[model samples]
Target: MEKITFQLPDDLIAQHPLERRDRCKLLHLDSSSGEMKEHVFADIVNLLRPDDLLVLNDTKVQRARLYGVGGQAGRKVEIFLVDKLKDDEWLCLVRPGKKAHNGDKFYFSAREYCEIISILADGSRRVRFVGAPASEIMEKFGRMPLPPYIKRDDTSVDRKMYQTVYANEGFSIAAPTAGLHFTEELLADIEKTGTEICRIRLDVGRGTFKMIETKTYEKHTMDPEEYWISEESAKQINTAMKKGRRIVAVGSTVTRTLEGCFQSNGEIKASHDETDIFIYPGFQFKVVGAMVTNFHLPESSLLAMVAAFATPEQILTAYNFAVANRYRFYSYGDAMLIS
Candidate 1:
């Protein structure tokens, strides 16, 4: 975990998104030789080979952040929806939990009410929304769950910019930041270069955001995230791997999903499951040959995973260069391609 720590300058953090999705700068790092190159995000098509396959996480982000008045004192509570347990029931993180007790009801609207059912061992609350479908209720009242580092409230532009061009199934609480750099035109150009594109779904959750809190990195375990790889996608990925083609994961979430579903026989199987896989330095790769990701937080699980993809020293060097060159960092920042 000591290796993960770095002094991330606050000014390097991006407060807002770029005007154009593919207009941001890209840092390309050669994994084998530790060489680095700089390019625009749109230069990605030229960097990819014809036989390479690009995998994307098409999990749509949900409006999981909500504000409501709860308790007998009518205190305002901030609720972050984490995961669903059953119909109308969700695992949620509620701020000022001392006041939001069991059986206490939170009002979303005049007609909508969510009750805290029980407190889980993880310190999250089991909440049941008694109204129309929870999805519908959230769609109407919930705010986009932006990462705290953004330092601003989510705006209308974030509703469009924070999501990927290919996002379809609404499940994730956070955006897969790497994919945010690819515009529809950029993806079309990549496909025109004969790079096969495929999709998988990993509902981005706290597991993707939480950093290593332990003294030893090996002792850290990730919170589980739900993922799904369709049979058609599995066949495509497995066939490409068998034919000796590179599989380029679009984001760290995609990297985790691919590695989580890796088979010992070198085949990728289609399935739906929850994964708690954590990738750091010294971790061996089984499936992903390359990755395109956003500049991550210092000492984060994401940075550790990127270090495993390249090397800690090389990645730190690239980060220092990016910062010196005024390249942005974190969600709504610049992009990086590790090969």
Candidate 2:
């Protein structure tokens, strides 16, 4: 495997999602011929073929951002709810960790509807809601959990734009960004051509924010993300594979979901579990024939996943073109279609 390296300007990171979800820039590449083209996201339909399977992540973004006191309202801490433990309890990361030791009690305003129980040793707290389910309390008081890089507060607009037109189904904290480029009209057009569309859920992790800490892929520990692959999705993909038709994953998340559900006999199987499967250069993909994705952070596991899907040199070349063309970068930015 060739060493993976690419340069992107920090200023290019998208601080906010585009006003129009499908209005973002796009970078298209043909892995076979090593040819590249630039266009708006609306041009996606032109690249897809009939009978190709476009698997999407239909995960909903929960209101995971919360704020309250870690005992004293004066401290005013930030809480990002990551996962649910039970009906009223959640695994959350709290801010101002130094002050929030064990048994800290936080009381929200009367109408706010929640309180914290205790802090864990890892700095994450196991908060138990005093009155209703966490969902209900979040609905009443939680924010959109916008990423830290957005450099802005979660507004009502983010409640819509940070999500995809098709995102109504897996409760995910982050959007499978490559799918963010598709509009309803685009999907209707793609489906009209006899192409198959399917959904899988990969509840993404906050650890996705971490960049690679090691130069060698074998040494890094990937954080597990939740995934669910149903029987119907498996049958459709397996039948397509048997017929020699291409399976196109709409994003790396879908790719990982399908790849994670792959059985030993080269067929997709129904699955319900967490996946920590890391892919880098030289890894053979079991299901993905083509992929659609966005520009990724430098040295991120996401970048390595693309490298595993295609040749490292190919990804490097395409990224160079993206940078030179000033295509928007990161989660809410441009896209890349690789085949």
Candidate 3:
């Protein structure tokens, strides 16, 4: 774990995204050689081969953060929905947790409200909606669940900017940041080069961003995230594998989904399941020949996985290069393609 830790200046953290998504910087690293070159994100089109299979996670970030007033004092409260427990019930993290004891009611609007049903061991609340459907209330009042590192209140712009253009299913709490750099025009251009693009789904959960607190990567545990692959996409992937084509994963989420679903028979089947797959240095990768990912936080599971994909020495060297070059960092930051 110490091998992956690095000193990052706070000013290098990207507070907001650029006006044009594909206009950001792209750092191309040769994983085997540890050589690096910089390019515009739009230059990704020329970096691919016709036989490469590009897999993207199309899981969309939900408007999961909500603000309301509740408790005896009518104090302002913030609720971040973590997962849907049932039709109208959800597991959530409440701000001022002491104010939201079991049976306390909070109102989002005149017609939309929720009552705390129970408090879980981890201190998250089990809440049930009333006066309106949970989805309806969230759609009306919830804000995008931006990562805490951004350090700003989410605005209307985030409703569009934080999501990828190809997002087709709403489930994740965070955006697949690597995909955030792509645009419809860029996807079309990649397809024109005969690079086959496919989609998968991985509901990004809090576990994806959880930092490594343990001294070693072996001691850290990953929370399970739900993922799915369609029969069409499965067949495409299996055929590509059989033909020895390169499988380029769009983000860490896609990388995990593909590598997790791989079977002992050397083929991936169409299926839906949960994965807590944690990749580290020494773990053999069965899928994902290359990766497109955003710069990850220090000592994060995301960075650990990137280190595993390449070598920790090579990845850290490239990261230092990126920092010295003044490349942006984090979700709304620059990207890297390791191949």
Candidate 4:
């Protein structure tokens, strides 16, 4: 853990997305040779080969953060839905947790309310919706779950800016940030180069924002995220693997989904499953030949995975170069290509 850790200035963390997504910076790193090159994100089209299989996670960010008044005194409460446990029930993290004891009711609108059914060991609440369906309530009153690091409230602009142009399903709490850098025009351009693009879904969970609290990386546990790969996508990926084409994962979520679904027979299985696959230093990657990812937080599991993809020393060196060049950091920041 210490080997992969580095110092980052606070101001370098990107507070908002750029006006044009693909106009951000791109740092290309040669994993084996430790060579680095800098370019604008749009230059990604020029970096790909005709035989590259570009895989993207199409999981969309849901409007999961809601504000309501609850408790005996009508104090304000915040409900952040983490996962849907049933049709009308969800696992959530509540702000002012003490005000939301079991049986307490919260109102999102005149006709929408929910009751706290129970509290989990992790202090998250099991909430049951009443008067309306959970999806309806969230769609009407919830805000995008912007990361705490952004340090601002979600605005109407975030509905489009925070999500990728190709986002297809609303199950994830966070955007696949690397995908956020690619515009529709850029995708079309990449396809024009004969780089095959495929999609997979990974319902990114709250674990994306979780930090490493353990002293050692080995002691840290990852939260499971649900993922799915269609038979069509499986055939495309397997064909690429058999032909020895480069499998370029769009983000860490896609990287995990692909590597996790790899079978002992050396083929990707098409199925829906949950993965708590934590890629750290010393772990072998089976599926991803290259990666496109946003700059991750210091000491985060995401950074650890990048280190594993390359080397801790090489990653640290490239990170320092990015910092010295004043490249942005975090979800809405610049990107890196480790290949």
Candidate 5:
């Protein structure tokens, strides 16, 4: 309920997504007193103990940014696919929405066709691609979900650099920004040091950028992000708990995916479903003991989640330091660890 102020400088906002997926700056935090220490992304290996279990989100990002014509030429429309309907169909939000209507025809690059089939009750439009497989569709006309800060269009480097190296299962519209900093070498070093790695999938939506619209963080319900916890993942996390090892979540998405399937008896069951779990202060964490996340926006859901992990004062202090140090902010920016 405190006043949230974001006075970050414009230069601190990362102009582009990281050129190398794993090469990012990191700030380690002591969850005890909230003290911070700066380090490179690779230094993460030192934080892992042999008995630690780390969970990662393997959900791949789809090229959600789509460009097309409205009912006529020169009426440019941007359809950002947020959720899937079929291989070549999706539920998306359209820009220049005034020009879109059911049964209207649209074009992608003047090369392919799109039709507005129906509008979903929640306001996303049902769109069908007329000429190509959705996988190939993005290769032609889709762009990455570059945060609104970049001030430019997604470039050639974004296609690869925006996603994590381990990303494979496709569903997410935006990259798991925290995982963007992990290199194969870092993963290997952590594994070599006896830390066990596991995976879950949360198809995070483009609503990731949505600002808090409610006065109370408790009042805001999260848009359901698609999630999957496999039998293997559940077994690993539950087993780690049974043995009293720490379970660290790589990002808020991973934290949500794992916590979504958890039961009150401290058991982790495997399931695939949508998750609307919003973690805020006063919530008891069921799975994650530590979290590696990115610097978040003020008065944002992401920052509220961090407040749940540590404390509001701790997070505010870290934010002030990040701003003072000129650390890059938001999705394309530096990383943090609260443990």
Candidate 6:
């Protein structure tokens, strides 16, 4: 993956989404011929066929970012909820790591407090909410978990702008970005074209936004995230596959869910499970044929996964074209459709 690198101009990073969601730029990549074209994201409906199936990750984004003071001396701490362990316990990434040691106490409000009980192997803290369940505390105080690259504070607009129109189940710290471009009207229009829509859940965790820090790609390990494919969704997907219809994943998370649950016989099982699947250039894709995704960070796993779908050469070429043409990059940015 070290070879999979790019130079992203600082100005290319989109700090905010366009006023109109579907108005974002779309880069079309033809995998077989390696040709590329630019169009508005709304044109996605025209690019699909009647026999195509669009799979979406409907994981809802939780308000996982928190700002509060901790320790007896009242030091500031930033808590990013990573996982919920139980009703009262949660696994979180805390700033000032040295101050969040075992037995440390953090106060969110006068009535809501948390105490670190143990340390996880990955340096995340396992803490117990003292005054209320962790979920309730977060609901009352947590802010939208915006990516650090956005360079702004979370605002009231983020509650709606950061979420996809169809998002409804599972708690994800981050949004399934490609879905962000779809409006309810656009989805209805897509359905009228006979392109069936199916859904799966993959809770986007803290690791999804982190850049690759290892010297070699082999050292990168994905933390397991929970996912589920319903019996109904499996039936629709299997029926489409049997008929030779295309399965178009909406984002990298959906791609991960489809590939992780795929069987050798080309069938997807309906069940809830955790997957740490890491995709790169040479991995065989079992379920997804096409995908809708956002431009990702350089040297990131999401970029590597896209590289696998469309060859590294094609993906990088398209990216260069995007940069030259001024397409917005990152979560609140433009979209790409590869087939």
lDDT of 1 at 236: 95
Better of 1 and 5 by lDDT: 1
Please provide, for model 4 over 144-207, each residue's C-alpha lDDT reduced to its tens digit, 9 standing for 90 to 100: 9899999999999899999999999859999999999999999999999999999999998989
What lDDT tens digits, residue by residue, belong to model 6 across residues 28-70? 9999999888899999999988899999999999898887687
- Cα RMSD of all models vs. native, in order, equals 1.3, 1.9, 1.1, 1.2, 1.9, 1.6
The stretch of ten residues in a row with the least summed lDDT in candidate 6 is: 260-269
Please list the residue runs of candidate 1 whose C-alpha ends up more than 4 Å from where it truly belongs after superposition.
Answer: 263-266
List of clashing residue pairs for candidate 4: none
- lDDT by residue (1-339, candidate 3, tens digit) is 565877899999999989999999999998878888899999999998999999999998999999988877788899999999998999999998988888888998887889999999999999999998888888999999999999999998888989999999858999999999999999999999999999999999988779888888898999999998999999999999889999999999999888888833356878888888889998788889999999999888999999999999988998998899899999999999999
Give the CA lDDT, 0 to 100, for residue 263 in model 5: 41
> lDDT scores for all predictions?
0.89, 0.79, 0.91, 0.91, 0.82, 0.89
Count of residue pairs whose backbone atoms collide, per candidate? 0, 2, 0, 0, 0, 0
Poorly placed runs, candidate 4 (over 4 Å): 1-3, 263-265
21 in model 4: Cα distance from truth in Å?
0.5
RMSD of 3: 1.1
For model 1, residues 123-181, the per-residue Cα lDDT tens digits are 88999998777898889988988999989899989999999989999588899999999
Instruction: Tell me the deviation in Å of residue 303 in model 3.
Output: 0.4
lDDT tens digits, residue span 45-134, model 2: 777889798888888888887777646545777777888788777888888766555566554565443455676767787877675677
The regions of model 3 sitting more than 4 angstroms off are 263-266
Instruction: Give the higher-lDDT candidate: 2 or 6.
Output: 6
Q: How close is candidate 4 to the true structure, as a TM-score?
A: 0.97
> TM-score for all predictions?
0.97, 0.94, 0.98, 0.97, 0.94, 0.96
Q: Write out the backbone clash pairs for model 5.
A: none
Give me the overall lDDT of model 6. 0.89
lDDT of 5 at 7: 80
Model 5, range 48-140, lDDT digits (tens) per residue?
778999899998887878878767444878888777777778788887777888887777755676788897787779988888776677777
